[model samples]
Target: MNQRRLFIASCVALIATAMSFAIRGDIMGQVQQELSLTDVQVGWILGAAFWGFGLSILFGGPLCDLLGMGTIMRLAAAGHIVGALLTIVSTNFTVFFLSTVVVGIANGLVEAAINPLIATIYAGNKTAKLTTLHAWFPGGIVIGGVLAFLMTQVGFGWKAKVLTLLVPSVIYFVMFMGQRFPATEREAAGVPFGDMFKELARPLFVLVWFCMILTAGTELGAGSWIPTIFNRVTQSATQAGILQVVWINMVMYLMRQFGHNVSHKIAPTGLIAVSALVAAVGLYLFSHATTVTAAFLWAGVFAVGIAFWWPTMLGITSERFPRSGALGLAVIGATGSFATALSGPVMGWISETHGTAQVLPIWSGLPLLLIVIFGAIYMVDKGKGGYKAEKIA
Candidate 1:
């Protein structure tokens, strides 16, 4: 296998995933206004992406073993292309919702394939490499955010913004066309399928699984709302709101590039604990911002807080539950998505019933709770000779 080529391809696929998130969020207010939908209805449409991602990754995990990572990658590309087109042509709520789900599924498939792919290819440096690979997530967000802002400034419609996603989607799909993919780390180690499932029941895995829900919700739920929330909070131009999303992601991209050094000094669990505390404060401060300057300042804190949450969560799980293979990764990823999906509508309701400013404060509680859970986990790991990856044997 050409590891360099595959890794590059994986990064591009992730770029597609991240772009969808940024663009979709940037255009959400336009969609709501154009469709004449209520806040609750808009929330459901937004949540579709997460729930769809949750379901696909849930099934795609074991299927990766059965089908092959290459095949899963192909399907992910197709989903991105199809979903993007569907979204572009969507005229009603049902079509838009289903199209978003397709996009979500595509995003989920990218994780199902690439998470294990990175773990397999860079087995010696799983956490750091995965962190570096995921830096493109924010990288893609920056790309998409900037594009959306520019397009909006140029008087482009929301459909034009959505169409831009197809560029990376096609690029990744063509790149993966003839490339060879390695077996998952578990498969290469000759771990049995049943043994992989057995890892799911382990106490550590179970605890992390539960924590995944909160961490994901804390990171993505608030992120998904940033554009709309900031728009409402500052009563500023739409570009300002999108720029806030771009700014936070820019901080995230830079931080994740240096994530390996941090991983060496702090266990993944410890990192998560600190991230939770910072995120809570950042998010709370952001919820109260009355000016674009204040919004950007607080968003920088929120960005650093969430930068490591997703990739590190996956990294620790892959390390500690080597036997669980892709399933363990998928389970935790799916949990995060589903939790975010559930929270989306609730966030909308909170915004509608209370105010847009109220949403982040409510979500800030998620990470506060995470600080307690991950802090305890960090202490336990420290007692056990610090955090270490398990061997498959």
Candidate 2:
């Protein structure tokens, strides 16, 4: 029952996953130039990462239950090692895209295993613990961003930036070695696959799943493209791209560190409602940023808005529909990743045709939509005797 070790190991695994995102975002320009790719083509490459993530987790959830979390985690570790090697050796767009897809599946598998794993371990405080566990995501981003910035300052190549990911990757692999995994909450509760599917058919669960699409799109769509978009806006070729990423992640890191306290005061649905409104305002202002100061200010605001999104949505699902188990969490995660995958190309197309600044306004609609959807969800949940966390059986 050494939950602490398992928790630390999960955080390390997530750090590796998040670092991949940071490195990919940082080196996107280099990858495009070396491969002679257009903005649209770059979108395809970036989009593929999310697509692989979405598709893998779509199925990986049930597999996690059937195959065991330890098996999935080991698979993710192998994927990370192989994908990094492929990325290091890639010399063409096809090779690079394929490599990213491999890494993306690894990332998805990590989410597939860890989301439910953490929820099961910290059943009493699912929201708080999940938020705390996910803090490493932004934490990893900050570390990766700083490293990428320093590497660029020292005249290192993108390959070196990518190679830095191996440090955490190796740490997670070793931590996962010889570890024991707990059964999923659903499995422990003796909830069969049929009951899990039945939970998915519930009206509230369906609403939350739909909201997950917008919540993820609003957060990750902008997050995945921020480095390139901000660089274009600031027109700086130095550390501006990576620095902006660092700034946003710094804000996100702090917010997530304290998210558990915030969740205690406000219900998850209410939090999502408020977060969506703030994100909409942040996105609108970011689209209009004409100065570095303005961009940083808006980005900070946007970070606060998005910080709670992924974990909070998962928390809500875990609390409200405990029976759905890993499949429930995976479906929501898949929806978010799919939205991000769909948005990458559209955002790139906007940048290619209209400009990077224009990408924000078009995406602002997603949060606005969430404001309406989650607003209704909050009211519905409130009417049902307010928020209640399901007890793990």
- Identify the leading candidate in terms of TM-score: 2
Q: Least accurate stretch of 10 residues (summed lDDT) in model 2?
A: 236-245
Model 1, C-alpha of 35: deviation from truth (Å) = 6.5
Compute each candidate's TM-score over C-alphas.
0.91, 0.92
User: What's model 2's overall lDDT?
Assistant: 0.87
For residues 1-393, could you state the per-residue lDDT of candidate 1 as single tens digits?
A: 989889999999999999998899889889988978788788787767777888999899988899999999999999999999999888888899989989999999998889999999988788888898899999998999899989988899999999999999999999998888888989988999999889999988888898988887778778878887877767775547767777888999999987656887888889999988999999999888877788889999999999988889999999999999999988988898887777677888998998777788888998888889989988888898988898888
lDDT of 2 by residue, 1-393 (tens): 678988998899999988898789789898889878888878777777888888888788998889999899999988998899899999988889999999999999999999999999888888889998899999998888788878988999999999988888888888888888999999988888788899999988898888887888788878878878878777876647656778888888889987567898998888988988888898789878888889889988999999999999999999989999999999999999898777777787988998767888888888888888878877876899887877656
